[model samples]
Target: MKLSSFAVPILSASTAFALSKLPRPHRRAPIVHDVCGSLNSDLILNEVIDSLGRATVAGHIEVCLCLSDVVKFVESNIVAQEAVKLLGDHVKVEALISGMITGLPTGSHCSYPDHARALCTDSNPCDFECTDGYLAFPPEKPTSCKCPNHLMECDGKCGHFKECPSKAPPSRRGNEPQCAAGRTMCGIPGTSTGQPWKCVDVTTDPTTCGGCLNASPFGNAPVAGVNCEDIKGVIPGTVACGNGRCIVKDCAEGFFVAPASDACIPVPEYATVDSNQQSGEAIPGSAGSIEGPKVSRDELTAALKHGAGIAIAHFGGPVGGLKTPRDVTSGIQHGTGVLVKPVEGTSAGFKATRDVGLAHGAAKSLTAGHMGAFAGTHGIRGVDGGLIPGAGTCAKGV
Candidate 1:
């Protein structure tokens, strides 16, 4: 090819003059012969030769030979030569020139870390080649083929992108339970039984089949009106009796029904007084005491109907209003009652009650005059009572 135009200006005239002064042959050897704009080895070789005209003493011939040796050096590096060959005749002159001077990657410069080789060949348009099994890179440069996700490099397969392969978890037989927690409990898959009996299934088993040390395997027991023949010692009125056994049933009346041993066990009783009841008991009391006069079912029903109030005397039982009035005859003369409580995150108890009472009074005032009357007893004055220190618009009365 026409290699004349691609050649860079000869070394500075001063440099050339200095070089020429060195006896015949040559002296300052081109220790590293890297040229730009030249791809073909022959052309590159020619450039070096032309740069060092032949006409010197025999002793300095070593200089000429040394200069020539650079050519062999460039050529011997199969990687660099192949890289240059790949660039071909289209290599950019400026890039080729700069790369030759710096020994770094230029446009189209490929890198082969294995061989540590870089080469420049054709530089007309720009072209390079390589054959040292090195990665094809740009001219006079180094580049790497790293994995996309920083995982690994492509497997030398062109058109293939680099990636990380997924690793699968080890597999185990189906019948064997993986005991990551403790021990495996599995059963034969093809067997008629559902699953092999195991301790792990008991206490944790919601099916109630049986497990847990305290549980019984009494099997399915009908609840009500069903023949309990299969059950032997099952007494009347007990959850455990359905399984042919007698068990105590705790009654809310502060007594436990003990059919197996007969006789009712009394619950702990406490003393209390009702403000409204005829009995002269004190407030805050508990159940199960035989202190008051024997109350007949009729008398209790009648007393409750008359709006007789029941207060927990002395015992500090939860405060509440009567829900149902019992006819003492049925058993006890009391019913359920809910105590006052703050929703949550509330500190003031009596204050909350007071405020709620006030609100209720206000709302009640809208419909019935009873609120005003009740408010008077609670030490609540009307809004018109005017503001006062340590009190709302209306000060509490009693």
Candidate 2:
């Protein structure tokens, strides 16, 4: 005998009404009493039985069995007095269960929550696969799969998009609790039960400064925050979180803090000198003066190319003109001490003499003529004025 969809509802109503007639004293039975009481109303019982019938027809044996347990629990709680009358007509009850189970169409079924069940269709069921970059939450029974962190979901797919989907503003009831002074209440995500709150100080908390980080409540947009210590290229021990922002106290040794920015930049190695002093006098503010062998242009260029620091000294007479220490004051002219080094990614350069003074006190640019005349193929000048040969590279003396 073929069972029709129309006949399933009639079968459920008749069976449920018959089951409800059992004595109320059995409703207190501990085993299935709570389950039976939850479905005590006729409308709830009929709807549950109808769903079970549809699921059974759709070959969902697990769903059918789970629903059947509810009905079996209610049936098992029949009072002893009523059992005699109910079971005496055992054939009738058995026919009712069989008819309800067997009489439904091979339609689709949705295991989603009640509000979302109606949205499910045969083509887009609750068990449909989520698009790439997204994963179904509650893997067994998912309602809406969520995108991974830092990713936004669009058109039912997740990607590296700029804007996130719009969310409703968080509603506020005046009765909500307030945080203490100097603290702001922030929401904690992924909570199962109710909304959880965290209190943070935005002014000085490095991870949550200025606001809560990636925290949203009531489906509102998340607040952005930054960690002060995470700023790139800053000296590790010189960073601080203050006034809801990152403050840098100093930069690395080879770098200096930018004039108008918090960023650190490499120190420049070149500067233009403004001195006319040709005397071989010691440069003021220099750490100290050292008398060394004359440095050839080729040698200076080689050292600068290798990022080695150099100090230059000046002599008055022609290259190799001075011979002895006693001829120093009379033969030697004004000295132009300077220091030069190569800056990374750039050609050889010079820094300010005041910042890095070498031999001469005056600041001046080193020209090819000066390099040829002063650092000729001769010996280096001693502090007292005599030229000495075989002194090592100028960089080593510095």
Candidate 3:
């Protein structure tokens, strides 16, 4: 299992100069791929595998940085320790950072509220009040806001601030809600837009809220209940506001952070079912409240676990005797890189991640970077091969 030739040429001119400056033994090593397993005589499969194999190897090589290199990489805008922690020790930390740094456009550096230690603190700076048990910001807080909730300062405006129902236009026979003057058709509870907003109408409108537009189901309704009121469930620790809203200062009796929204959720009672399965891994039910794929711990866990078998290592720098295989503490940014190597014997095995929902998205980009760094393949292209080997040429096996 000798290391292979260098997979892709180290591109950063500065990095190349730095590598040249390092002693011969410290220079970037070559990576080579060995095809000892089942060979695909089929040209298509062979071409695909051959093209993908180098990258597969590189993917495995990125996560084993020492605490020092890992910290430097984080400080250098190459990687985030928090993001790396989520990926855990099995993946390459330094190599992944190097690969990403090498591939970045000239003058590009990890930046903004997206990176670890963003200039902004997510801690809710505002004192939020649960008016009569409903979670809300003060009317002074713009009702329409896309900012991260729970952390951002909110002025505590809770409850239905809708125009008086008495002022609403007449209800039509066809189930269409007519709006009064100065109002337009809108989702109820008045979204950012000020028109007569569309209401979830949990009280009535089955198809709209829970079941029907007429009979209202407030508390216990089917999960599929169209009525907004019916769909929201009640838990013990939460304060129930009249109209339709619940304030949860803490997680439900059985849940933890849903991992997706970073919000509290119901923890599974079956934590013992599998060491792989644990609390705070699934996307909490709250995710469903919003549009788009809600980040869920369960889904994220599945993604993180799927790639665990890949072996990773830091190949260069003063890396000897340094700690490797660190945990990814937080989420990775959109284009963050991840290092990987093939599992010695098995193609797959148990995988773990700190936040499950984010695992899949982060894995994709990390794998992309792995493939690109090692095989000269595009990051997007590497995803097709799952956890294949990358360029380990002479140092490890191809």
Predicted model with the maximum TM-score? 2
lDDT string for model 3 (172-236, tens) is 33222232222223233423654323324333333343222332222222333333222223233
TM-score of each: 0.15, 0.25, 0.16
Every candidate's lDDT: 0.29, 0.39, 0.29
Q: List where candidate 3 sits over 4 angstroms from the true fold.
A: 1-177, 181-250, 257-266, 269-398
User: TM-score: which is higher, 1 or 2?
Assistant: 2
Model 3 misses residue 172 by how many Å?
9.3
Q: Which ranking of candidates, highest lDDT first?
A: 2, 3, 1
* lDDT per residue as tens, model 2, 260-314: 4445656433211112122334333313332334444444443333333334434
- Quote model 3's TM-score: 0.16
User: Of the pair 1 and 2, which is ahead by lDDT?
Assistant: 2
Model 2, residue 227: distance off in Å is 1.3
Give the Å shift of residue 237 in candidate 3: 9.3
TM-score of 2: 0.25
Compared with the true structure, the alpha-carbon lDDT of candidate 2 equals 0.39
